[model samples]
Target: MKRREFIASAAPLGLLFSLGLGDVPFANAQTAGGTPVPGGVLNVAVSPEPTLLTSAFITTMNIGQVSSKILEGLVSYDLNLQPVPALATSWSTAPDGLTVTFRLRQNVKWHDGKQFGAADVQYTLLEVWKKLHPFGRAAFANVTAVDTPDPHTVVIRLSSPAPYLINYINTYGAQILPRHLYEGKDVLTNPVNNAPVGTGPFVFKEWVKGSHVRLARNPDYWQKGQPYLDGVVFRFIPDAAARTVALEAGEIDVALGSSIPLSNLNKFQDKSRYSINLDDGRYLATIFLTQFNVRKPYFADKRVRQAFAHAIDRNALLKVVFLGYGKPATGPVPSSVVNYYAAQTRQYPYDLKKAAALLDEAGLKPGKDGKRLRIALDYDAGGGVTATRPAEFIKQSLARVGIEVELRGGDTASYLRRVFTDQDYDLMISSLHRLPDPTLGVQRLFWTRNIIKGAPWTNGSGYSNPRLDTIMEAAGREADVARRRALITEWQQIVQEDVPVLDLVEQTWVTVSTARFQKTALQGDGLFASYADAWLTPKKA
Candidate 1:
């Protein structure tokens, strides 16, 4: 059974709209007849508030969910996952695959009333993404230059063939930013990050702290007569049960990111009241793993890392923690991404005896108090039960082997800073997306160059292997498909042997919404889409 789905409205508007809450704006939205209605608010439930609006630098799921609507990518993917036009009308690649060119759409303007052009794309790629973006550091490593012949034409020059470069030009990945605003400023600390300006279907309205983020429709949207809904309000409901109850009560129209607990999904199984999506808007193929601070002397030993892997039972973690929503992962890449996934590598089946022996070999024997070593474990507080439960489970499992774990947690914003920026964690638990391609997702987690401070979803472990880096860099530039796959396989094996981080499970999340919502499934990403064409139908007569 497909475990994850989102919730949309099938009934009429709730009392919240009738009472008139302008601070968190909502409307009596949707169609009267068969045609889609132009006016109404699509109230969405986003569990944790995003740290910022734009996903150009930080690819946090919540950030992508909201920012995708405001920021327009050069292209958007089709139902077949093929690149289609968004900001860039047309594009071409050189025979050698080293040079690619894009023709920007004319008459398109940024949210701040500036003309969108090649200069915006050029600066976003070279200055922002390459320098600051966690994944872009690895994905766009070979990018030598982004030349703009005219205001509408952008020519990208690469040092080697990057066949997978086209896959990440979408809004959720390499979002285009305005050159005028970001020209001579510190991007990370820029005030505009809190209130983004973009070229998309939605305009930046207001974000009430610890409340909701409200967005209004962009009247000057490049797509003609589209983005049918008037606006969107993503409410922050911290509790999973409360989010589900709100959806059931019609307070919120939709809920994505599996905010509702898996055990509660049966209540919404009645198709008449609720609609479900399996593989839609879920471009993020998530891998739930624990990253260790390898800089610490206790965790630096290879045997210690291997012992930690053997200590945890992956099968039990899948069944108990995730409620069997996913399968145990083999390596960095999950089985869902069949193109590059490595089927065979070193396996760490549950073996208490082996775990104890390995720990002893690493000179981490039980002391007078029966404690081998003490460590702190941090987790994403926003992930609700899914994240919190796993931390507890790992702690329990590791306890049997004489390792004492102190669970640490905080808000999503502070958690990212603690682990990635401060590097304050001994062991950090995070569920990160492996994206559509390994170059865009998997490589960033292990690549030496991607251990950037203040960047989330990066190599915070401080682990580096020159051979693995060589393999990853070659795979990124490799033109031949078979050769690239082989290189990727080798990369997985090296990580498995080194055990920098324990790749636990590959999760398949769901999106639940009502049938009244339209055009959400048009894009391959499902609920993670820009929602430009998304609108609601009228209540059942």
Candidate 2:
């Protein structure tokens, strides 16, 4: 079956929006109708050099934003958060919904000049995606086989129906890798990861470790006359204040992951010089959470987790830490995911008396020193003040309930190792990007099968509820949209009652860009976009 044939046959699931041209406007680009001038470099500010260049293993958004320019997936989400074609020209699903076929685009070449075909997709799905990807393991759990009948045709046969498979393939799901290069080599230690070869708009050039990573435009890009800029340079700033200073001084053209300090956002309101885009965050669904390690004796009790939840006030965290840039989250899924979000779930109101009562009921009584117990809490310092400030606030709140928290702050790598690998920390304050669907993001938080020992972002909390797991599995296979949503709602209620992970706040990301750049449309997925769609505007004399 062809791409158009599938679209015509399958009824619209309401999740698929209209493919209108430029339906979602770029947050702050000057769209006033001047010709796009090419051949200039676009400078971006990134914090803390990414430990891994491969998106298959990366936990932080910094690495994905940088690597996206070098790697092209089978599909990408547009500004409206709808699935759009990338490497695959079109796709169709079987009548039973257990099979999916993708029609590849011809003449697409990898950076190494080799033809991109079905084999590349097959290898990426079997080796990297199904086995190694954090979200893919659960998303593709029902996949029985991936068949490539021809060079341009790829078919996926599943044991059951997966409605959200297309959504995953659009974002982190289907990043195609060259089978010839990664087939027989150690994928984790492959040299190609440091210097990648992809079919993206930019070609990998050089990396100067902790300083910067550079990329040149791909002249032979599939989208002809694209990647308007000559090159792109990502500068590692680490400090949010320093990133804002660089943007103000015109040292950088754009900030990738909203590294600019929230207090300094008002200073860049000049229309002619800078464009500040505080996006609606529909595509970039992120939920700030306080994760508990149920493996620890102190946190194994549900009462203790509920006590901590009632102690901390999410509204205060929004104002004090985010500067009123986000909303208080209710569950693992953020409000931006409108289809499956259950707003009526259990809410934890801030009450010190209730918190104290619950702690006492859990048998955690204070000693003569007036401290119930001491627990270690860690936060990611790479997120700058946004992360550290919240940790400080949580420490103060937990102390009021007689639970002493030793706050520990570290870089992205250290925090990942402690929580994911070592599993030594008692509590962790971190943010996870909630995808458009619950199956893509929320399932990994509580799924028992996803509790991979060495994995960085998959069920690190070691949380598993048999009832919730069954609901998640049924939701993945349910073809009826309403039935799947009902299943998701049931799972949310269970998670709220269980209190495995406490939802804190949903953040709103702000991206700042210089007026020298044009057509800078920030997609729903986050601040980053295919630089190919962006062009440099000529400066006035």
Candidate 3:
């Protein structure tokens, strides 16, 4: 049976059991009024609290899984990563592809009991452009302004023609936030931060700090007879082992981010007792890289940078760090991103002999004591086991090349603030989780002026090229699809050669849930996909 149809038939029984309204005939779930047939609290486990609730700062998979449940973007991605309509019924782009106008659905309502309107679009665009909200700023960076001609119509004017504009607008950065609540002072600390209101199928009810969050069903959801469960509870479990344990023990209904290590992959798969969704490589996960402080004297020369890339065994490190979970990437863009990512692009293969030669070429040869180049390697140790091990492995590999490397680690928040954002490190390992488009990622990291004081979100590499900057600008405004792609490919080539950010691996996400919860039917650019029609079956009740 289809996942939705199967859920519709089984939800009543599960709801009856979950809500403790059991022994009542399952047929009574079919009420005449068709009001919310409520039951059950879907207990879930999330990893950590995101810096910000809105898409702007949703870096971790846990945050994406949680926010996706609460906020509904205008456009959502299908399993194949295709754009599908969500809030806006349909949209059309001008022939030039520089301007896009959307026809908003008139009947949608915000979770705070207010009518959702075009003003929400204006607020979101301005905030993203001005504040650097993390969900995705590059996607909307070229948008000159947003215009609302009517209550149900919104028009976006771009600086350049972009065929993929609609797809980007449907991403997380374009998520609609309630203007009425976030417009005033202390908006950051408003109860809404902890508790958000959205037009999505789920409504935020409670958040137990450092543990789990709860979301009740929105009876007034735009889509009728949807949101099969009464509510969804998201629990936070940082440890992958504990998360898997909770899932197997039924302490949690589902485990969202399942990039579990290979050693533990079988622990979840070995058990035929529980239904597991083995979607090892759903999306083209972006690269994990180390950015150097070009402003520092030690790494000022291009030869020094080239030497560093050549010193490390990327293939061996990939296997050790990911345990064969991912593939080593050669450039900023992943292979999955077609039209722009070229496989033939130059890659700096590992060779200690060449690395030593480059160091000599850069005039950073070893002293009489035989101690070669020394540099500080910093990483955000706050990601628990996932962040620490790879960081240590990178250090060890660098040492093998006779390079003196110092390991500096700190809490996630402090590290991101003092080291990365402040540009106070020699070298650091970091990863950008989401890149809807290749240009979006490149623009954020390489745009010259974007590295200024207020816009220091990216550019951690402290590397920029005037030629590439102009190409990025022209590409952003170029309306011709073919020409735009050509520019993107050229820019990527420049980035790869500069080696400001040494590309590493493309991660894979895994998910495990009960068979009652449909697997293939998941949707959107998140781990949970969509729960609009998801339902849990009762356990032999």
Per-model C-alpha lDDT, please?
0.77, 0.76, 0.63
| TM-scores of the candidates in the order shown | 0.81, 0.86, 0.83
Candidate RMSDs in Å, in order, are 8.0, 7.6, 9.6
Rank order (by TM-score, best first): 2, 3, 1
Expressed as tens digits, the lDDT of each residue in 373-479 for candidate 1 is: 99999876555455567889999999999999999878777887888899988998766667667887788888998798987667889999989999998988888
Compared with the true structure, what per-residue lDDT tens digits does model 2 show for residues 1-541? 0111111111110111112112322334334245778888999887657766657543346667788788877777755567778888899999898999999989999999999999999998988888877567767778889999999999999999999888777434456678888999988889998888888899999999989999999999999889889999999886667888898888999875556655676777778898765542346576677899999998899999999999999878766665555667788777767778898888889999999999999999988988998999987765545556778899999999898989898876788789989998999976666678888877888999889776766788998888889999899899888999999999999999888899887655556788776664546654445677777787678
Q: What would the TM-score be for candidate 1 when compared with the true structure?
A: 0.81
Rank ordering of all candidates by lDDT, starting from the highest: 1, 2, 3
Q: Is candidate 1 or candidate 3 better by lDDT?
A: 1
Better of 1 and 2 by TM-score: 2
Where does the lowest 10-residue lDDT sum fall in candidate 3?
A: 9-18
Selected candidate, larger lDDT, 2 vs 3:
2
Which residue ranges in model 2 land beyond 4 Å of their true spot? Answer: 1-35, 51-60, 280-284, 296-298, 360-374, 380-386, 410-424, 452-454, 526-528
lDDT of 3: 0.63
